[model samples]
Target: MLKHPDTTNAATSKLAATFASQQQAARAQPYPDYRSRLHALTQLEQQFKQQLNALAAALSEDFGHRCAEESLRIELLPTLQGLAYQQRKLKRWMKPEKRHTSWLFQPASNFIQYQPKGVVGIMVPWNYPVFLTLGPLMAALAAGNRVMLKLSEDTPATNQCLQHLLAAVFPDEQVAVFSGDAKQAADFAALPFDHLLFTGSTAVGRKVMQAAAANLTPVTLELGGKSPAIIAADANLAVSAERLIFGKCANAGQTCVAPDYLWVDAQIEPALIHAMKGAFTRLYPASRLQQDYSWLCTERQRLRMRTLLQQAEQAGATIISCAEHSWQHYLNDGSGLLPLQLVLNLPEDHALWQQEIFGPILPIRSFSTIEHIFTELSTQARPLALYVFSDDKALQQRFLKHSHSGGVCLNDCLMQVAQDDLPFGGIGASGIGAYHGKEGFHTFSHAKAVHSKGWWHPGKLIYPPYNKNWLNTALRWLLRR
Candidate 1:
């Protein structure tokens, strides 16, 4: 249900007051020392550990039947690890970086101070709610910034759990959580935050950017598109299928970085399909009935997937189900379950081929040559991730050099995002800016460059003296560039 405009306006006004308070707090202590930052991170980590089971249960309740084990593995573990990584490195990251000055500026020095951007606004997504909410919050806190998180309306259960967890450790001025409907989200986006981070679909990301632009707020959008998995001619079919299927099947292919489609050599198409089927059966013999298999988060998402599948089937595309039983069996029970399907030979104009499939439907296309793969991908927006499976270094290098994506994972899938040292984000339409590890710290920080000079410096020689021979020489040298 949508929120009333008056209620949304009241919430927005209260949020504005909190933002102002935090801004004032930041002014009082512009930079938090390493000890204080570490303490905050430590408190968050302890609270997360305490609420692990509750969080998993809340997530399961929100998603109808999300596996607690999958939640622990995917969302909880990574967040804890990220916090630890930040804690261990906060001291070094907090130190100002020394920079070199040109020879002409001898006795002068330059350095960069990483200062926190005050009052960061984090807009969370329904899928992987805990991870997305806490992930950006970790970065913002690590950079010594206050945070205001707007929780997703679709995950009310999880939001309540998270709200309790946050309320126990921090004051409202430090970290606040807001929960509301779509109208509230629009109002929240309109706030003049120092920085805003949103994670969701490409269509909505555009609107978020527009709202942020009104206040000239810097934004980091983690949007999703149709990321692809390519199989080289010389690749191992079984290995490629296993890794790709794992990523596509996790969370029932609701992951933003999940392989949306596949491009394989024509000769190995049959072999890859057979391998993938075997892998799926071995992993989950009951398919959607398996304990760890997650259902589509909402009924609307389920209907969207069904419509896309029906459209493809009507367009003369072959649909191959990976389930051991009929898909209707699960659907009849009102489980919102969907089978992992391999869609073959979808027409270019088909919705299955055009839209980002956020379900367990993999569109497989055959490519005779590498050039053909490049041509097909060139027509679409830049994807957030690209997966390549090949043992040949030359082929891998060729694909890496020819294509553009936010991140590339070779011989695997979705594991690059787990690496704390690397930056996770998108390029063109996939997303804007990145955050993870030091990149995340810098993303939420302002890199202010400071230049210091001594009184006995060479700058006096070049200060508005047109008649002096030394000044003329200095000007000529400086202008030589």
Candidate 2:
């Protein structure tokens, strides 16, 4: 989507100016010292802490009524944790890693130095705006890169709050925030950035990649797909249902890594669904979903979920609403309070099964045997996250080795991305590259090789134009392998 020509021109001009200014700043301080980086991270951390209440309130307002406490717990906490982690480990991460020189290159030293990639561009999505913005921001800042963030326009209130907080903590050159319409965001992506990272749906991710390709800018895409969960024949029904429900219901299942569907043993489908529905009711009683639970961030998303459900129903799928009241009663009331819904007997050609369901909907497909699950999964595009529930370690190992996903949880869901030490991303269509913790620092930096050779000059032996003896000897020794 784009705006009028005049709007596009204005947005392009503004973004170009910002990029130029940031480029200048990056040149002035190509690499910040460890102490300077730590201090800057500390400053941002303090500002984030001070504005926690406001940020949470802004998230609530932007989503029409998100639980402020939930915002703090889910968004503010992770952002702060990542900042502190980077601050503590920045010095060590900045040091050069010594590499072993081959015997042929004796008296030479080889090492890798992580250098800043100059100005970086980060595109934030509406869900978990604060955390997503800061997660990569910390990595870029830790690696000493100037950053420009294009926050989602769907989240105006949270974007305003982030703009104020970022402005108070860092200068426009060191860190810039852009909250604009789709046209401006499109223009921002097209800018020639040193590196670009986008977090959104696969369809939009492709467009972002296309725009970045114009500048030859490398991208780290964190996209969502049909992340599925498997319930093994021997799995614990109660624990699996509890964990799966939590993963699917969190943020009303708007999370990129949330479980999109479940492949369960046909014999246990009824029991598993019953346990999940009960667990959800306990988490957010059907009677009080409007008072306690989060709604979809926008009405458009709400409508999409509704349409998907209607489409599935039209195709003769059996629908099971988790709450006492149907999803429509809560989600359709202007507020997007949707409850967990289970779809069974859905046709393979149904739209719900074909795409990522970024709402509180789970399609339950029954598998007769473990092999049956693997056979079907092997034919589909790799998903972002995979969940398996079983006590059998060998079965777990089999899934681990056979399936390819961005991340996997042996007996749980959504826990893989929660850790700061882990690299979070997808593969294939799900995404391109990952960035979190150590991986993130390198993502925004270049691993420049620093090789040094002493004055010993051992290579003088092979300098002659005609050195038959040396050539034969070297070839004999080298070609022995």
Candidate 3:
């Protein structure tokens, strides 16, 4: 059962003690214990499927009218797919990788073994709670490490559901979940786990990294920033607008990797904006409010977006609110959904242009050429993802070569994250390590190099001989080789 205490001090002590006990137990256990742990995780694969469905339902209720299709696509599918992929690939991933030895070390054999890093702490974000939690949890479990998950306080229903589900299937000493306000999260971060993984905003990621540093704990930060979408002059306007708009508005533009702004070739800026407005109008018609758009997940985010929009207007930006069609009846009962919007012809210095706008509002800017767009993006902090829509292969290659971002989608946006086979991560500020496929497994595993050697291959040529002749001979032989 989940524990609750009247006093904050008592609760903190209790939770800290529980976490400490788990860490100690995992460390003190024998090799066989690791085997059992792996076996339990294997069993959890089947059990978690049903739990995921229930958890998704809980999450949908929490978000208030989040489409089941979107939840399944984003959350359930990714987790189950990760579990299945790991189950089939882990044995191969565990095999010691042998390396060829140099002629000088002929008698020695070298291999790199994958070892567990012990307990791992996962701090899951609220936007995609299930996948964010399971993504890291799976990696930790696959590498034979125990896990302690801290769910976002913003997602209370999802957090409670995850806590209940995990408690049912595993002992507290194996895996546990904790949830509370931001202060509680700060306390959780202070605990020294073998490794800590955090997925959230860039600002919060810094705090997490600093806290983990106090205990010398290794960290993998998956943070988000202002990812830009570049639409070239020669691109297919309809296809480009369709895909980019779909990605931007899919989660009501709340995604970290969502295209933050558009850098359109100046020649096509007018046409692209028209296409975007048309695409949004078709999906979220004013006639069908509930069926068309999803609500902003939290009131704080809504207020933030509202403030940004207001700021952009004050700065003389053109706010082209998409004409609402006919989806009004569904939203009559107080849904927080807003019409998809485009902020066009904004000056570079506008407040909305300065930060990551995590809403349906897309700020459109015009660039004269590819080089100019590249220079503009290069000046900003590396974004989580960059979308370059172009038919010219040469232009695409050139842009990629000069740009530095977390990930890129050629002629598209956001879909690159779905290609499970590829490694996904940020370079500098966006994030540290890649996860997904074998990369995820390796990220959570400790690879140790081992070398086996015997006395049979003794070097008699230079065995501490105090002679000039021996030294000369050795030097001559090394130079000749």
Candidate 4:
């Protein structure tokens, strides 16, 4: 159903008014004390505990059969851990950071006070809805900022559940959640927030930034790109295959940081493929029908995956389906289920190679040398995450030094984002700014510089007197290398 233009404008105006109210409230308190922030976080955690099962079920229904266990493991656990980490570290993070002053300014002391950035706007994506929504919310709250969350319309069930959970603990003036269609999301992005954070496609991120630009709002975009996993020649094929399968198959590869493709040494390509097939078979004995496997969130996503596979196959790419069950059954059942597909030797200009494949399709390519891998990656924009499977520390370090990415996982995959202590974000097309741990606190904060001077200042010598005497000599000496 198409929404009326007048209705859309009215909704936008309503959201803006709410934002203004939140901003006013934030100004009244300005900086929330440690105790207040801790209390808010504790309330959030308690609410989650009470509604954990409901949240899991809501998320499952939204995803057309997302495993409740997967939702709890991937979404709820990480969010709870993030909340605990913030509660434990908020006091220390709020302390003023003392900075050393130069000898020339000995009488003055300098420090940075972290202040909240008024009202913050967060745009949540459908994939990992709970984790993404609450993860950033935790950081914003820890930094003592009022929050306005725009939940994804695709996950209506989860959105309603989240709205109820948040309302139980916080008033609209402190935290608000909006649920609507794309028009509402666009209006939400256009809001003049003190700090705005969005998680979604690179294309939408550009639009969000453009909208926020009119307000001069600082934005932290958590976007997705074609993240790649590089398998070293010396790495154990079995181990790499196991980890890669887990990372890629989790959530049916709808993750933004999921391995979009694999770069393997030409010699190990066959062995790695064999290992991956074995890994997938063991992981999902019934293939797409396995209870552990999550369906694509919607029919559109399933069709998009199918189109990518068909395009790759028609363009002379080798298509390998790792389905131990009948594919026709899944299609006839209308389960939105898709088998893990490996596309090999795809053309450089193929659509699957160009776009971020946010589904259960994994494109595998072989490279002869490390330089070749670097050369290939150099042509693309920085990815949100990069995975390297290698036993050699030197090789891993070299790759780390040469390659650019938001985060890198060595000898494993996807676990880098699970660490609450580490900052998770991307570079270039992948994302802008970071949010997690202390970095997250800083992102949602303004580090105001404070300079304290004693009553007896050292500037008496350099007062407004028009004389080039001892002070001038001292200045010249100080300026000298």
Prediction 4 global C-alpha lDDT = 0.90
Deviation in Å, model 1, residue 322 alpha carbon: 0.6
How do the residues 309-384 of candidate 4 rate in per-residue lDDT, one tens digit apiece? 7788789988777775433445557787777888888998999888999988899989888898888788889999
Worst 10 residues of 2 by lDDT: 458-467
Select the stronger candidate by lDDT from 2 and 3: 2
Task: Quote the lDDT for 193 in model 1.
Answer: 93
For each candidate in turn, the TM-score is 0.97, 0.97, 0.92, 0.97
Candidate order, lDDT descending: 4, 1, 2, 3
lDDT of each: 0.90, 0.90, 0.79, 0.90
Q: Name the lDDT value of residue 455 in candidate 3.
A: 80
> Candidate 3 — worst ten consecutive residues by lDDT sum?
324-333
Best by lDDT: 4
Question: What are the per-residue Cα lDDT tens digits for candidate 1 across 425-463?
Answer: 999999999999999999999999999998799876657
**Reference-based TM-score, model 1:** 0.97
RMSD of 4: 1.4
- Over 1-481, each residue of candidate 2 has an lDDT whose tens digit, in order, gives 6567887788688788889999998899898899888988999999999999999889888888888767766678888889889988888999999999987778789999999999999999999899999999999999999999999999999999899999998988889998888778888899999999999999999999999999999999999899999998899999999999889987889999999999998999889989998888887885667766788899899889999988988899998998887766765676677888999999999998898999999999998878988887899989999999999999999989999999999899988887999999999889999899999999999999998988895666666676578687876998898
lDDT (Cα, tens digit) per residue for candidate 3, span 105-185? 677899988777877888988888888887778777877777888889888888887887677678888788888667677
**TM-score of candidate 4 relative to the true fold:** 0.97
Off by over 4 Å in 1: 2-6, 477-481
